[model samples]
Target: MWSGDELDLDAYLARIGYDIGRDGELAPDVRTLTALHRAHVAAIPFENLDVALGRQVPLDLKSLQGKLVDRRRGGYCYEQNSLLAAALERIGFQVAGRGARNRSRGATLPPVTHAVLAVTIDGEQWLADAGFGWQGVLEPVPLRAGARVEQSGWTFGIGVEDEGIHVLRSLRPEGWTDLYAFSPQTLYPGDFTVMNHYSSSHPQSRFLGQVVAQRPGADVRRALVRETLSSVRADGSAEERIVDTADLAVTLEAEFGIELDSEERARLERLHAAGV
Candidate 1:
């Protein structure tokens, strides 16, 4: 429910820089979905800079809104996906918060590390994800299988990652490669705390190790901390950059549109230097 129309909708949109209308119904057309996806890509960046800096990445709604929609900060999947869900819901889209796991990482990894959205309109479920870093899709992929969901020329397919996990696969010249997996499980904010801790603290986690990503443009996505910052084109093959954090705050603002305070910057720099 909205806060008696006193909520700052424009500020919220400005925080994310998502150009979509804040007070109107989310347009159900494919064009709207594409545009929204691009806005998210250009606006919300995928960065673990906060965790590396020892800042607590809170999952509560107010905290999330303040950091992501007010302070113009970037966050990991749960925060990014969760905030987007709130905005879409306010715009009159029937959105469902779904859980996902990284099948490529390992089967035993904790659940709910990834969050996705299932938007229903005209009784059809459309996949809307703003949080699956690097290989993130820029449009709603159809939920049906064998039905190729083509965007910007590349084709995607939906299938089973496991009994309970549904996977998104990219149709390449060689074969279909797994993209990511999600379940119908709707999670509360509390479910993410542990995962966030692991992602931020666990040395074994890829994010904790090193990875750099930026949403340079609506359709342009890149990251290098993984040793490869790849930018996927409408066509599948991508251009890559080596990841490094020389001037992190500048990168945050330039690449992700995040504005960090001096205290926040000092904390982040300290953490990065400590590598904890």
Candidate 2:
């Protein structure tokens, strides 16, 4: 029941790259969720391209849409999920911000590290995620247990964990694997920014350490840096590519719609060379 003023519709739509006047009505059923999910995946990519290049990424609504929807840039969890929350709310859907786990290398349980969305439509609550790096959910899944929901060649399930926490899982041929956990709590921008700062700045931060891998889907893409490695899948197989310093600027602009100046470019090159 979080209430903010009705968002500025036209500006928001333009920012997200949808022409508003033509499509006055948005489908409100499962189809609506599916369409939005597709548009999000196709339009907004899961990338730390900017951060890796030593750029500052803001999570405010104006900046989020301005980059993704307006300027045609992509972003990480906070940027993608925040703008999505705004879009859903503007179109009369109930949405809340929430946090999710960032799986650790040796831990049995996933660690909380990113932001996501909880949406309620037609009295049924669902988890809506647009920023999970490579393994993100591509469709809305019901907020109930023992039910398998399919999304972009992946299946999801919800189950109750200890302490009454809700766990989200991805189903593979082997079995079910935990993705993240959360209570039925609503988060605000400040909440996400705190986590964002930690992930972006900490020395142990994976993003800062090396190149990371992320693919929105099959035929989409993947990235590999000196310290990071990633594979993208469009048809469910991995597509891996290595980018060099020579390709960095063009890749950011062409792949993520980010514009960098000469000084920013020099700084990014230095950071890439330093690998810190």
lDDT of each: 0.64, 0.66
All candidates: TM-score: 0.78, 0.80
Quote the RMSD, in angstroms, for model 2.
3.4
lDDT score, candidate 2 = 0.66
Residue by residue across 174-234, what tens digits does model 2's lDDT show? 5777777887777887898888887777766667744343445634445545534456543
Q: Give the per-residue lDDT of model 1 (tens digit) for 69-160.
A: 67666777877776766666665677676677765453565544676777777787778887776566767877765557766665778885
Candidate 1 lowest-lDDT run of ten: 1-10
Model 2, residue 222: what's the lDDT? Answer: 50
> Best candidate, TM-score-wise?
2
Name model 1 segments beyond 4 Å from true.
Answer: 1-7, 16-34, 104-112, 161-164, 209-211, 216-219, 226-249, 263-276
Ten contiguous residues with the weakest lDDT in model 2: 1-10
Error of 1 at 183 (Å): 2.7
lDDT of 1 at 203: 70
